[model samples]
Target: MSNSGHPKDHGRRRGLMLVLSSPSGAGKTTLSKMLLDEFSDVKLSVSATTREPRPNEVNGKDYFFKTQDEFRAMIDRREFLEWAHVFDKYYGTPKADTEARLEDGQDVLFDVDWQGADALHDQMPNDVVSVFILPPSIAALEERLKNRPGSSPDMVARRMEDAKREIMHWRRYDYVIVNDSLDVAYQRLKRILLVERLKRLRQLDLEDLVRGLLGEA
Candidate 1:
């Protein structure tokens, strides 16, 4: 079975890929956590990484940690939906795991940059719904990056420069959220997911569901 496209809806709904991208200081990470915690059916796409696991990180749950050679083999085999090199390490979404979850009717969430989002959408245009989070202003984004714990002034400056470039890709997203307030932006994000789940393309089985109610199915 193909892992990156729509599966048969059958009697149940097919899952969707929710791709959330933002600059470093935006509230996308926090909002994604909220969705996972609040929704029982939503699952985080645990990535495969070539980097060493952190002190408290688990191998499978946090990330599928692998050697560089192993990662490259998967890449060569076309096993990743999207993969990237970052900070000298490789990270990717495993096609098998993601596809299994989707076929089982569970929503999968992706916390990726615009490049990764674009790649995933290209591979699974029908299944993917991309959202770009924005700060109220660049100054606000700078302040956020600077205020982060353990963030040095130099680091914040570099991130601010990167954020400028990131914000330029806002037009590529299917939806955009201006994160003026964390709570409000989160609400908007939730609404977008709710509506997207109800989309006719995603809810392909809804026709029979409605027809059955009318005794015509």
Candidate 2:
């Protein structure tokens, strides 16, 4: 927990988990990166994966890439908040690290898919705020996919097909933003985070503040 207005109350304030989910090429990754860069208090949750790192990915920066056996062992021990196999690769968010950050009052950001978002919400409904990002149109989404490196015609078509199913989960999210413009989408995401952070239930010491205001504490 975190105390927004007072100090010396180390155990009083807690943090929040903000999740942003979108299909490939919808600009969720770009928006998350920009939000992290702008918000000093926000920390990105680096997920653990069984997939090998991409060309520019760093060991601890992009993800904690692990072998299949290692990932499976964690699963056996129930160490993940949520785990899923996507495109034949395994991915999971470590439960301990996320809980620790929240207890310490540092907001955590998750760029995950719908399944993972649902799992987190089930585990921590009050602390989780999910947002779904949509591309302006399927045609625009296809164009973005085509422009990405190593993307083939077949891959683009498959992504477009998958995107339709993913967008159907948009209603499951607390907020939805259409990525027509990166700048506008980023601002909307920022606003969402800012407002969520201010929710009264999230601030553990709010009772004291309220009573003080009324001279009744």
Candidate 3:
């Protein structure tokens, strides 16, 4: 409920899962890369996937590659914060991995869909700051998808349909930025992160900070 300023944040702050969800061509990936490159303490949410690594994909850095049986065992153990089966492969965020980062005061960026965001919010409502990026219009999103090198006409059509579906979940997010201009959108997203980091509840050292303030009085 502490919304305005960092009055009690002279000490360590707990980190959050800053989720950025968008449809195929809506620029979430680009924003994620920019944030990771510019912010020293922010990292990507490297998911555990059952799929084999492609060329140049390194284990642990690119993904935690696991066999199907191993992944199922993890599911039974409840090691994932959120997980889903997509395109015949299981991908999930390990609870230990992301929670470790959060405890160490490093934000983890999640580039997931709306369903994944919902699952994350349900698990850790206070520690999740969700953002949804939107294309200006479906026509614009379709054009962007069509221009992408690997997208076929059918692929673009299917992505457009999916975009419409994804856009419907905008109201569920804490913030919504239209990816009309990359620079503007990034500025807004960056500001949101800066503000959320200072929320009083996230400042884990607030008790010590308050005691120090009283001592000064």
Q: 46-133 in candidate 2: lDDT tens per residue?
A: 7999998999999777898999999999999999999998898999988888898988888899988898899999988989999999
lDDT of 2 at 102: 88
* lDDT order of candidates, top first: 3, 1, 2
**What's each prediction's TM-score?**
0.88, 0.83, 0.92
TM-score of 2: 0.83
lDDT of 3 at 135: 91
- For all candidates in order, the CA lDDT equals 0.89, 0.88, 0.90
- Winner by lDDT: 3
After superposition, the stretches of candidate 3 with alpha carbons farther than 4 Å from their true spots are 1-9, 215-217
Decreasing TM-score order of the candidates: 3, 1, 2
TM-score of 3: 0.92
Residue 101 CA displacement from its true place in model 1, Å = 1.0
Name every residue pair that clashes in candidate 3. Answer: none
The 10-residue segment with the lowest total lDDT in model 1:
1-10
- Give model 1's TM-score versus the native structure: 0.88
